[model samples]
Target: MKILRKERGGHMLDSKLIRNNPESVKKGLKVRQGDSSLVDKFLAVDEEWRKVTIEVEELQAKRNKVSDEIAEMKKNKQDASRIITQMKEVSARIKELTDKQKESETAAQKIALEMPNLPHLSVPEGMDSRDNREVRTHGKKPSFKFQPKAHDELGRNLGILNFEQAAKISGARFVVYHGLGAQLERALINFMLDLHTKEHGYQEVMTPVLVNAKSMTGTGQLPKFEEDLFATRDDNFYLIPTAEVSVTNLHADEILEGEKLPVKYACYSPCFRREAGSYGKDVKGIIRQHQFNKVELVKFVQPDKSYDELEKLTKDAESVLQKLGLAYRVVELSTGDLGFSSAKTYDIEVWFPSENQYREISSCSNFESFQARRAGIRFRSNPKAKPEFIHTLNGSGLAVGRTFAAILENFQLEDGSVEIPKVLQPYLGGQKKLEA
Candidate 1:
């Protein structure tokens, strides 16, 4: 008898974990404010599939035994037609059961793919962003003698940003950076790339801005967030919302040696998004642009050292702001505030002087094995060892446009001029400030 091979669509959550520790999965879903009933639904389908599989196996075993008996009857030159007919009936039954088994497995795996990753133990439980805990703050908030102007106004006054021209060219939620504004944006991108590659131990990479649907799903962006994405007309390709999508999937369906446990990449790309649900929020500035530039940091590491690597990744991002002398704080995202694929997250909010508050400039996240599992990224501990899912992590080393805005707002002089940060001065040919 030949055993039927099980087919799978792609890598997903640990099926064994879901089957054995169902209650644990339920608790995790509950903590994330997700419906725990999904676990029950998955369990029901999974159990049904298991039962069908067992029945198919039993039928196949019976057919194998009957075939052996028929072979013996033929060798003795006896009548074997009745038993041969019985074997044909058993073969038909096995085929029917096999079809049912495939259907049930597909249904079970569908539910499994829809489920989100479980939050890490260190991730605090909460209902929303308000419950997030502040980890630390860096640098002093710049004190202005007079009321400061917003970055949009400052950019317009200096003749470095043209919103009107941008609207005429590309509709709203887009901007045209003129002269020094464009220079500052370019400088920030280079500064971040250099810092991450030269100092932070990451290899710089350039990736495609347009990716296929599978690439999107690999990074946990599709299947649930299709509305928020910008797709091409004829193809199933999507314009990436962040460099994370492209960089993190660089090692998709790959297996690495144990000696190269932690592989890191820093990529610079122009990101696109539909911003579907964020109406009337930061609509006046490049903060919520339809297209913007960012330097993304991605890491694929062994599971045991992922969290430790997370801290270092965060610090690497923070170092960008520190070098620019921007005041910012790090906040640990609670369960509900955490991203869909992230087990834990830290949002680095930069201080905005005009708003008298902070806004997110970067989000450092540890996806653990959630993304790795989905993308089929694995690593073996030794030559003879079994391959296991590698942990994936990514963060905006710094959103370049936001950094440009922060520099404009935080370093604006009372004389309507914006002082260039010392670190960025060399990149701009030592220009000290931008003035009208």
Candidate 2:
């Protein structure tokens, strides 16, 4: 069996890959608009660490040989103090080299952790959301006779959403769903969870919303995007930005049976984010709230089946909108717009009538082995086969709050009442509409 090397706090890319093909790694980073110089820094530190490691090994070998000679001299009752004194100097030099080796190794690993995952070859080459390619659009946008109202305005008029009260309690980017609004949010969560588990072959899991720092680092949320997360004062725990953080980390530092190659999980959790650097954008409603609800879909699969699994995962997300008869489109994210941990991604953007455009409701991504390597999640084909990192994929089966907002906007009537989607009506005790 081959020994699989593990690193502290995990790593995004294989160190051997970066060391042997530095140019290829740099090229990949350039495609993602990342700093290619990081690869150079890691290589330099790695080389220094390797040199120091060799020096330490050589010194240890010399020390061992001299120790044997000194023992033999003592057995024969001859003086061995001179060689013993030299060995002390050699031991001190070995300690110095060993410390240097550990430092360089740590520096190299830190650089590796900072580097983003390379974009997939299939990802479109361009910058930002404008460069994204639209794959398909679904459902027809609802036509309203009167001017369609924004979700916030509609909710406020119906007395179901209270942003002012929420603001007083928790500051901006928060909402208090009252009466039917609260029920609607709860209904959406149950609806999404049921649809995924019963129809999409996903096992439902309720994971912790508060995770440790190691859990965050395992899922690629640490060391780079820490500012975007809401952490406790001591920084030992963080409120989950999405269930993906807690759910994906479930198999961390563990190996699974290969026969269970595609492990799928659907988790519903309250997500929290600081929404850093977006103070001016989408501040009007729950569209970009600091806290929201989501049903996240996560998968662990064989590498060969990951892309196919990505497509399936995306459709599972789209199914939510389709079932609700919501208008949406699937857009392939460009390399520059790809996420830090994703190799390829497709965003499910739902039409918002008031905005007169589409807003992303979910992002379905295939991380290849990038996250798996970092989380130490692996699988073996057979007991005799070597373990390999499994590919990881996740998406919002549907962001519950966004789905709630979409319904409010798309189903709003001229009379200020909101019609419930036929599919969700059962969840609300056969109620067909929400009126003031």
Candidate achieving the largest TM-score: 2
Residue 264 deviation, candidate 2, in Å? 0.7
Per-residue lDDT for 21-64 in model 2, tens only?
99999999998899999998988888897898789889999999
In order, candidate lDDTs are 0.89, 0.92
Candidate 1 to native Cα RMSD, angstroms: 3.0
TM match of model 1 to true structure: 0.92
Candidate 1 local distance difference test against the native: 0.89
After superposition, the stretches of candidate 1 with alpha carbons farther than 4 Å from their true spots are 1-12, 58-91
Model 1: lDDT of residue 390: 90
Q: Candidate 1, residues 102-201: lDDT per residue as tens digits?
A: 8877777667667788999999999999999999999999999999999999999999999999999998999999998899899999999999999989
Measure candidate 2: CA RMSD.
2.7
Runs off by more than 4 Å, candidate 2 = 1-9, 61-86
TM-score of each: 0.92, 0.94
